[model samples]
Target: MPFQAGLGTGKLAVSKVSASEWRARSHAAEQAGDLNGALEILEEGVAAWPDDAALANSAGNAAMRSRNFDSAIQFFGTAAKLQPRLLEFSLNLAISLSRIARYRDALAVLAPFTKEGFSVARYCSVRALAERGAGNLAEAGAWFEQCLTLDPKHARALHGRARLAMQRGERDAVSRYQQALQVTAGDAELWLGQAQAMAIAGDTAEARKIAELLMQQAPQWLDGLQFLAQLRLAAGEADFTSHYTIAMQRRPQDHNIPAAQCAVLAGLDFNREAAEFARSAREKFPHLERFALLEAVYASAAGENERAQSVWNTISLKNNDERIHLARHQLRRGETDKAAILLDLVLQEDPTSISAWALISVVWRLAGDPREKWLHEQQGLVAFLPLQDAENVLPPAIAQLHRLHDTSAQPLGQSLRGGTQTAALLFDRTEPEFAALRDAIGATIQDYQKALPQSDATNPRICHPVLRYRDVPWHMAGSWSVRLSGGAGDRHASHIHPLGIVSSALYCESPPDAAADLNGDPQAGWLELGRPPPDLGIDLQPITAFPPRPGHLALFPSTLYHGTRPFTQGRRLTVAFDVRPEKEPS
Candidate 1:
């Protein structure tokens, strides 16, 4: 072929080459370990052969390999358009769309095939995934069932069904996972899912053993290592990072082991050690920006402000997450204005960011910005609803929760200290007591939503324009029970739920001391709202405090910081949940 000179050296004269030649050259570049170069060649080929479905599909595959889902979606869509009759092209387009969380679009692409009675297991499985991602759980389950009906041993469909069972708190989740594993025994994710199901079903010991075996088999498996660390931490083992240490010893050159170790340490609240370890890791792997960021965050948590700031100064903030951490650091140093600037920039880009909103509330409070009052101090924002039939509900609920608190220590990265939180989602459990409590809480949430102020765009809560409380879609993002053993300095740290629109604490049990008059020395076990974390060096006090009552729920904006006062004696049990809006205000 006669080639014309391209605009740049090393660039392919794609116009002069056939599609097959372009694919061949691209494959050669990929074999030479130049993925970017291969992708460039494929893109040029795509431009030259705009009408070629095969060439477009090849380019889409290249983009998918690069983890550029948007580019893959574009190319896959082009291919699907050019070859409307080809099932593979449409399937690829749908898969690419699902990868980027464009679930509705994915479903739209698959709709025609569904109408045409396409009975392939893969098609049904893909539709199930899209439906699941779109929060249509029942539809997802039906699709998965259809897939299983067509092909009983389809591994992907079985896996999807098992996952859905887990999410729904079904007792059969373990058996479903087992069924999936029977077909694909070598899948690490299936094994992990089975282990998780076991743990949720109150088989923590067995779960730990499975995780331990997995770690021994695959030293560099980050998920297995993290799961093992959580299991160890829950068991009150002092040396929870032992598996990580062993992994490092076995795979000395694996940078991911050290990185995961750093994250595990920080997540488990070993801030000082995490800071020191991350600094050392950065020294060894100076090219990893993640290590630098980890060092800065852990250093800040450890109260090593100077070291944190020094590390932050060296880092180029690449994302809003990094900027959020920088803003937090500034807030801790009492540099509210600087923190405000960073937070404003973040909110400008992602107005739905709960972290940014939470931090900005603090900034406004410190800088005397009136928006603080508009955000947190609005009337009816916080509600205390006394559950009906509290006397009947309390005993069984508390007893059921006590049985679920199998661990000796609190969970990693949670606000609770000197307490043990339940391992499984409370609402999803098969216990009848939990079901009753969930129903009661659901009714309380409806009442609370009804009482909320009219929709205001500036308000975080009730910002959605929908006026009917029942019409606005929402779901419980998380539900966990906490049992605090009093007299051991047991309390919750002041914090906000970054993923929730509305947060709640339902007091299932309260200590005798907690019920005492507030005139006493310490307002024992009282829930405190709007109190900034002590480490943040903010001089603010709790805007309000509530006495814990059995079967009573306190609902408030997730952006407001909340915690509890330490009591001298007895047990305090509570169920907490975060309510996530299905759609946020535009």
Candidate 2:
């Protein structure tokens, strides 16, 4: 086609000829993983019709598919500027901006469409989404409401509003979500919202059930994959990854999906792929702090200390929590001091920090009194606990994910008000336990559970043990037999159990070369357990501070916080678990 005057025609020519031709070429190139061919053709299209919105849009899509986010943004911006009247162009621009996390720019692009004349439901939906991306919760909510009134069955608005409600801890949102589902039952986003609400309400089993349903239905939803990973971890079922692996089948290159994959992967074959995938994710979504976290963990796991540290250094301020989260993971690799430094830094900014303080106290449980840390942790907990509105629990529920050895709470997050929880004590009475220490932890758990009632878990009174290993009783389905090879250092921050009606640490083997005590005694590290906030000493008399011995079990309720000291010796091997009872009939 000859060049035309109208901007749209120019676009049609470039996209219909040069751009479309390049796309076909790019597809074959990408299918063979030929980056150069794809980049050349895509870049050529960019140069051919820089002002043709469709051509630019096509170019951007090709770039983004190849993980060239900067190129994508550049091309998308050109398209958006050239054709500001087209909603698709603007939406594409917005999505591209979000990928680069230029959220302000994304919002600015959508801002013009939210004016008085922009009464279209789709326009309102676009603005609502942009506001949400900008973290303006209240403004986003209002826009979503406006969109809803215009189109009662508006899918995007319903989905976005339900997510906002979940984030803000809005109880009324449950009804809103149900209505949204009624409108769009097949929507993965709506399903995710429903699952999140159920998770926050401490109906994790229900959440898991919904998640399984989603997995069964879509099998490829990102949120569904993440939820299943967390749910498995929470249930002490670490390798429960069938659904997530299936998700990877659909989105093989998604960095977050692989991050979820690595979380549950074990064995030699998976270890290599998981570590590499984590690295690839870091390279792909360089701005997403969460990617850095996965990179750090995998690097540390692979004994690439410098890369892990380098990854940590690159994280921006917006990702402070992610760094802290990784630092805690280092504790698992035997990097106590490093983990401590991270905790201190986080506490410096948030002295009333729930996660840092809780894990800090838990890590130090073996040194002396755990009460002070416990007390300090309580302060953080109490600060947000008045939000008895059950809908607000998803973030906290996310925070409740207690990974083995890695105690960092930021891996999960506690960024919202916790509605009043009945705080019941759970102890899997049926599981095996050390006769000497069982009663002590059980009583302490009961006392604390009574004093601080949280209504998040089943059997809010006492949790009976359901799963145990050959020797490790406190461990839930998620416990593992892990050994760090070669030169390795680790960090495990503080955290509570997910399905931890009761939680425990068991040392199956100890490195003969690890550090001992303040006296430089050559011995294994201690498993610390305690409360948080005012950072009180666990006043359980002599019984509270138990020095770990091989074959000696340390069992405590899941609600009680805990962390492990970095075992400085050779090949520190341990197993841990969360203990909860078989579900009572509904």
Candidate 3:
């Protein structure tokens, strides 16, 4: 209680007075709703008193509210720099950068946040979006998954993933959208996203129901109206065409609904409307092969198979891009061998033609020759990817390659109650036999690398998946196992592996979500690995088709033909994969 006028106490008294004045001005400005004015006052106060982290942060808040993102960044940076221990400013900087589309920068900013990792759902959600827009899709996907793992109910992440899934044709996206609704039942945007996903999945019925709910919940949502129109047109509802035509009345650039409408009416004996819609779409974006494909479908349904085929032929020669679509139509029209020849020709010209490989995959699946196992792998590996995704769909043949020895059960490989099936298998998981496999092949690969000692990226064969086999390139990425499955009665297609690759399948546990489960869920479908057609001079005949057994394993060249039959019942199970020697470095 000594009235000793201490220097420190006097300095504190003066500091308090200045702080009180700043707070008063800020509080008044905030109460009056002049967030900008409050922010200006805080900036001045913090500038005068550089150690005042609170004042600096207050300015940042006001800057953020005013959408002055750059200023917010400056204020947050100053605060963070002045008080190096403060977590708030750094995190806020990451948030603001994310908002302004500096996602990669934001990610870099957030490296510090991973220290003891804060579970910021919105932070991860925004970061994932930024990464996606930045074209780092793989990283974005992993981030989106991380966001969901932290907060399964993270609405934005769920919505983004749903959109991604739809784009990748992962029919399960519709279910993810529904699950997102559980977390945000009141969120109209999530509802709208679900509607969009359903429509994309070709389910117009449920989309309409959700659209109706969205209209009720979010009357002003433009996406809801768009989805409603798409659903209506797809369902072939009365005057749906008129509805789309009229919607074009208010907002004519609605490519989404009209494109969908064109798709719906294309094949069901309705060419006139399909033509009209496709014409409008073509006017908007001329190079849509899907529309051309629709036009061909319309012509074919109208008993103009020649006209339809001509349309495909005309478009096919327009550019290399459309050839695959043309080939797809050829197969749909029962010209399977012709489609195969087209793809084969393309592959012969360019061994790594993505479109040719993709078409080859499609043909192999339909061909049902176990020899085509290599085709499926190539489809997965070499397709012209708008994005690498789940649709590198494993053909059923990749799992069980039945060389046309017999349409009967033959134990694959040596345990083969004879070589009645020379079929090779492919898988994704490891097995005990794979242990000797992992040891023997693993050692061989290492020794091979040691002898060669790769010095260049031109090594065609590189190990891709496993941790131990780190140096293998794409062509040489065999030697690993994968889990594959088929039901009681499934056969592979015909195909060949690439020049130096050896493919194999080792039976593992059956797909847990097999045929029985297929009927149990709307999203669940039977898992059958079918083969694609071969492109790269791979006239590899059909591999042996053996009925699936849990322990069965087969090893053979990439040139074998393979595919799977649609499962009627029981779960066909196995591990299926490929192995190839390292390409001699060129």
- Which predicted model would earn the best lDDT? 1
lDDT of 2 by residue, 373-438 (tens): 343333222211111222332232222322221321112222101111111111211122222223
What is the clash tally of candidate 1?
Answer: 0
lDDT of 1 by residue, 148-236 (tens): 99999999999999988887667799999999999999998888889888887878888888998899899999999988887888777
Q: Cα lDDT for residue 119, model 2?
A: 71
TM-score of 1: 0.84
Candidate 3 per-residue C-alpha lDDT over 510-532 given as tens digits, one digit per residue, 9 for 90 to 100: 34433354435321212222233
Candidate number achieving the greatest TM-score relative to the actual structure? 1
TM-score against truth, every candidate? 0.84, 0.42, 0.39
Which scores higher on lDDT, 1 or 3?
Answer: 1
Candidate 1: stretches off by over 4 Å: 1-55, 82-87, 115-118, 386-409, 423-451, 454-473, 516-522, 568-571, 584-586
Query: What's the lDDT of the predicted structure labeled candidate 2?
Result: 0.54
Q: Any idea what lDDT model 1 has?
A: 0.82
TM-score, candidate number 3: 0.39
Give the range of the ten consecutive residues with the poorest summed lDDT in model 2.
Answer: 415-424
lDDT of 1 at 102: 91
What's the lDDT for residue 573 in model 3?
A: 39
